[model samples]
Target: MSAHVPQICVMGVSAAGKSTVGIALAETLAVPFVDADSLHLESNRTKMAAGTPLTDDDRWPWLDAVGAEYAQAGASGLVMACSALKRVYRDRIRAAAPGVVFVHLGGPRELLLERATARTDHFMPSSLLDSQLDTLEPLGDDELGVAVTVDRTPAMLVSEIIERLRA
Candidate 1:
């Protein structure tokens, strides 16, 4: 495991504000924030844009790459936005980047879908909401992570994380 105690993963369903909040969290922590979506291949982007939900295999490499970055981060921890919907997906990332911590941002399906619907130019379409939900695992008490509700202001969420990390 890496020695960094608080390397954070701002994870959630699409449109759940992973990218938006990850950037803020990273800035607050004085670390680099990465948008994992930028790492997506054009093919995957095309597939999702066409209303297709990606299988686990489609996401494996991307997760691996993100994990690699985490491992190489050394003391300068990073925050990243990734829809780590399943336990397996999270496991793979943690496996590569030991000591990685996740901040699971979750919200009501209706709220998420509404945001997705309002978005433009994003690769993911609102139609895949159901598929995303099918794979989502709410962070459990024993999950070795923080589960924060995304139903509040970003500042509130960031404050929650900042306090958690400090504690």
Candidate 2:
């Protein structure tokens, strides 16, 4: 691991293991971990719970909040799990925390749906998986990030992320 603590965003569609991998990665990196879903307004959560997808307007404030968290972390660094499903959203966060690096967790639709369905605690419904997937824009070549398949265990994924980030 590098001597410098990293500010990282674990991004993906719902149930793509962003939170799981993010938590482990933070622990390994000795930084704080936050799930960006916690930053959502109750109205947004209610909308998602009702199987409604959020419009861009509904997300702007929430994304700004997530970005603020990253900005607040400063040099201490932070690991955040956020469904930054679009390049614009990622850009918004980057504007706030310029050094933030995203780690995109990607997987097949079947696996994503299965995991989304299995999770009973989240507000986001499995019905919204397709919408999130539809909105997702993979990390571009110009982006400071890496894309990793989520077929492996969280430990393996975190290790890979650590290695990639280090390199």
Candidate 3:
């Protein structure tokens, strides 16, 4: 089972580099990648774009669908970029695939807000940054396999993850 490849959820609040690092990692691993934001309903996107935070109830189904897609992928692993801020959200993913590994892209909130502000036309607005940060849960020390922060370059981040997986 050393080659056991679980779906990788590149998770964190907005602007934490989930999508950036996930795509690079997917390319390096030659696996398919999913931008979890793409699965959001138009209404959810609009709400967030309007600077409204979505409740957990509103996010449950959307999260489920992303998990379902990877669960359906069989042997091939998938990398998903998402702001799975709450432990309950992570729990849902675990329920779908026990082997799913979450790579939390975490860092200083001010840095994230700055990045969010610089981005254009994104669904998540800078206004909700604090709430996103509030909802974040750091991985427990013995949780699973590799869990990393967004403090490094994309290549470095991907390299660290690949090394962890290989070990």
Candidate 4:
């Protein structure tokens, strides 16, 4: 693995506040912030906008792009928001950027649904929340990261993640 401890990925299902917390966390760490959703291929975006969940085939290329972005950032490090909802997805990214750490932002399905429903401009429709939740695979015990509940304020969550990383 590379020695890029702070090349962090803020991961979660939709409405888990990956963007909000990821941007804040990047600012806190004084690193560049990238939203993986922005890296999505137009085709994937179209599928998502059309109320269709993407297959792994649709995601592989996008995940590769995301991984490349992280690897390209190099030792300066970066904070990125990605819906790395499965272990395989995280593994794919780790394959590209060996030392990327993942911060799994986890919460109840109801909360996620509420948050997704409240959003208007995002390409991911609220209806996909169930599929996202169903697909989520919690961080394994050996994963190089921490899992924080999103029930608290972003500041609190950021503080907790910082403390964990320091350990």
Q: Which candidate should be chosen as best, given TM-score against the real structure?
A: 2
| Residue 3 Cα positional deviation in candidate 2, in Å, after optimal superposition | 4.1
lDDT of candidate 3 over 1-167, digit per residue (tens):
15765578888889988899999988987889999899988888989888889988889889888778778875798888988777788888778777777788888877888898998867788888998888788776655546676778999999998888677
The sequence of per-residue lDDT tens digits that candidate 2 reaches over residues 80-145 is 999999999999998898888999999999999999999999889999999999999999999998
Off by over 4 Å in 1: 1-5
> Best by lDDT, which number?
2
What lDDT tens digits, residue by residue, belong to model 1 across residues 1-167? 23354578888888999988998888877899889888787888888889988888899998998888788885778888988888888889989986778889888899999999999968788889889888898766656668788888888999997777566
TM-score of each: 0.92, 0.97, 0.93, 0.96
Error of 1 at 23 (Å): 0.6
Off by over 4 Å in 2: 1-3
Local lDDT at 119 for model 1: 95
Between candidates 1 and 3, the TM-score winner: 3
Q: After superposition, how far is residue 54 of candidate 2 from its true place, in Å?
A: 0.5
